[model samples]
Target: MIAVWKEWAGEKLNESEWLSLLDLAQRESAEEDALVRGDLPVPPPPVSGHPRVTPPPPAPRHKVPDTPPPRPSTELDDRFGPWLARQLRRSGLTQSDLAMELGLTRAAVSAWVTGRAEPRSEVRRQVAKVLGGVQQFAPLERWKTGAAVLIGVSEYTHLPSVPSIKNNLSALTEVALTGLGIPHSNVHTVENPTSAAQVHEKIDLAMEAADPVSGGLFIYYAGHGWTDPRNGRLLLGLVESNQHKTWTAMEFDRLREQIADSPVGSRLLVLDSCYSGAALDTLSAGLSSASRIEGTYVMTSSNATNASRAPQGDHFTTFSGEIIRSLTDGIQGGPRVIDTDTLFRHVRASCEEQGWPVPSRQIGRDGDRVELMSNRWGQP
Candidate 1:
C-alpha cells in the first residue's frame, strides 16, 4: 500500500482513477492468495488492446413519496422584536402599555412577542428613543479594575506569501495602548513563534498576569486569521514547521474565558485580521456572561464582509495607524481622553481622508453600552 501510494503520488489521479487502481490491486491480491491456498480459481490477465466492455444499464428510478410541505417561514413582527422584548422585560414594561406608548397596534405588539413579525425601522427607532429617554438602555461601562492584554502575532516560519505586515500593526497597537495609558506591562507581542502551542502558552501567561484591580481587561490580536472550513472555528497563524498546523481562535476564546471567569471587571477583545468579525459571534457564545458586565467587548478590524489590509507606505494598517493617532492626540498627558464612539469616528475619518478602505465596527454588550476609558480627551 505504501509503495502504491508513493507511485501514484507522482501521477495526477482523479478520484475515480485512484479508486479503480485500489480496487484492481485489492482484487488481484486476494485472488493470488486464494489460488496459492488452492481454495479458488485465478483469472488470467486480459489481452492487450482488447475492446472495453460496456457497463450494464442502470435500474430505473422509482418515484419518491412527496414530503409534507414545510411550514411557512416565520419572521419576528418587530424588527427589533427579540431585542425589544428583552429590553421591555428588563425595564418592566408590559407589551400592551409599551405598544400604546410607541403608537404601535396591539396586534403588532403581540406579533412581536410571538415573533410572527418584525418591527419596522421606524418602530425600532421609536423603541430605541423610549429606552434611551428613560435611561432604560445604556451603553456598557468600562471595567473599574484589571488591565487589558493585547497580543499581536505576525511573521510566519513557513508560508512566505503570508505577509509580515502584522509587525507594523503590533507597533501601532503598542504605541496606541501606551498613549492611552495602558501600561507596557499590560501589552504583549508574539512574533514568529515556532508553533501554535507557544502562541497559546504566551497568551495564557499574559491573561494570567493581568491585574484584576485595574477595572477592565483588553485583548488585541493582529495576525493571519484563518477559519476551519470543517468546524467554522477561527484560527490564528503561527510560525510552524508544518504550515497547516496553527492555533485556533477557539483557543483564544478559552483564554478570554479564563480572564473573564476571574474577579476582573470586563474583557475587551480587538482583532485585526481577515474574518475577525466572525470571531465576535463565536466568542460571544462561549462566554459565561454574554452581558456587558460579564463578558468581553469585541471589536474587529473589519466586518465579516471585508478583508483587512496592511498600509502601503506605513508599517501599520490604516485602522491601526488611525487608532494610534487618536491615542497620541494631545498625548502630553498620555493617551488623549476619547470615548469609544469618538475613537471609531476618528478612525473612520482618517480612513476616508486617506482613501483607505474602512473596516466596520460592531459593539455587543449584555444589556448596556460599553464605555472605553482613556485619558485622551474625546469620545470613543
Candidate 2:
C-alpha cells in the first residue's frame, strides 16, 4: 500500500501525510464500528425562533498540501552526521519525525546525528531512500555477535553410538560458532547428556543469560534420532535411554515448546539425525510457528525416513561436516554476515551434489533473516 502511494505521488510520503492518512483511516473505522453496533445518531435540538431562519454562507475549506517542505542545500553529502542534521533543519523535521519516517527509534536517529553510533549499511540505505540523500553507506565497524546452545549426544546406552557427533559439536563450537563471533563463554555446550533434564537445564540457562533484545539464538543438535511409532513424534536419545524407559530421551515437541516460550526475537535450529524432520514438523505446528515479532528457522539433515550417514573414517558425520565446511569456507564468497537461509541453500546444494540426503528448511514468512555468523570479527 505504501509503495503504491509512493508510486502514485512520485515521492515518499512525508510525516504529515502519513499522520493525516492514519487519522482518516481511524475515523472511517470508528464510523463503521458504530454502524455495526446499530448506534443511532442524535439530532440537534430544534430551533425555537422564526421556524429556522436562514444563516450566512460558510467559508469553503481547502485541501491540505501533499508535498513536504523542501530541504535546503540539495547537494550530495556522504558524511551521515552533517547530512542528517542539515536535512532535519531544512525540512523543519525533528529527530522524532525522521525516526517515524524511517521506522526506527528516536534514540537511533539521535545517535546517527550525534555521532554516538552509526547505522548498518541496510539502515543507511533506507535513510537515503526515504530522506533523499547520498546513497553510499559504509559497512559497520562491528557486527552484533549472538549466543548459541549446542547439544550433541554421540553415545547412547540402548542405541548404537554415533561417534562422529562429538566431532560435529566440537567443530560447531570452535569453527562455526566462534567464526560467527559468538564468545567462547557464551557458546554453551552439552555433550552426551545423560538425561533430558540436563539438556533443557542448559538451554534454559543459556536463554536466561542471553540478551534477546539485541542479538539472536542458535540451537544445534546432532545425535541418534528416533520416532515414537504410536504418536509419530521425534525423540533424541540420551546417554541413559532404553526401549522400556523412554523418559531418558528428549522429545522434539518438548523442545519446540521451550523455544516458543523464549524471549529472543531470532532463533535458528539445526538438527542432524534420523527422524530429525519431526523437529521441522513441530516448528511448523501452531504453537511454534514464527510470529511477527520473532523469526524461526529450522534445518534438518534429512527427512524422517532417511538416515544421516557418518562415514567410518570421517571426523564428523557427512551432514554435519558439510555444514561446518559451508560456514567456514563459504563465508568468503558470501555476504560478510551470513544468514541461515543463504547458508542452508549452499549446504543443501552440496548435499545434492554429493548424493547425500538433501536437507530441509522451514523459514517463517514474517520473520526477518536470522544471522548465523559474521565473516569479520564483531562486537557483542
lDDT to native, each model: 0.51, 0.65
Identify the runs in model 1 with alpha carbons over 4 angstroms from their true place: 1-145, 161-177, 211-214, 241-262, 288-295, 330-336, 352-358, 362-380
Q: What's model 1's lDDT at 16?
A: 40
lDDT of 2 by residue, 1-380 (tens): 22222232323445554433333322333344458779833333455653533222211214334442221111111234554675567444689977998888999999888867767646755664554321111111111345678999888778888788999998888853335556556688999988778878878876775666765677889988878877878888888877555566788888888877877767778889886876776677643454434577788988877777887778999888977877656544677566778788878888999899888878765343766554432211
Give me candidate 2's TM-score against the actual structure: 0.59
Residue 288, candidate 1: Cα error in Å is: 7.6
Question: Which lDDT tens digits does candidate 1 get at residues 1-380?
Answer: 22333334334444444333333333334444557788853333445766434322222213211232221112111123444565566544678877888887788888876767766545654654454333311212333223454555555555443344555556555553543334456555655555555555655665566554445556667666666666655666555433255442334455545545555545666677776666655655555354335444566677654667774455566566566666555223333234555566667666778776665554545311334544334322
The window of 10 residues in a row where model 2 has the poorest summed lDDT is: 134-143
Candidate 2: C-alpha lDDT: 0.65
- Give me the candidate number with maximum TM-score: 2
State how far residue 188 of model 1 sits from its true place (Å).
2.9
lDDT of 1 at 310: 71
TM-score of each: 0.49, 0.59
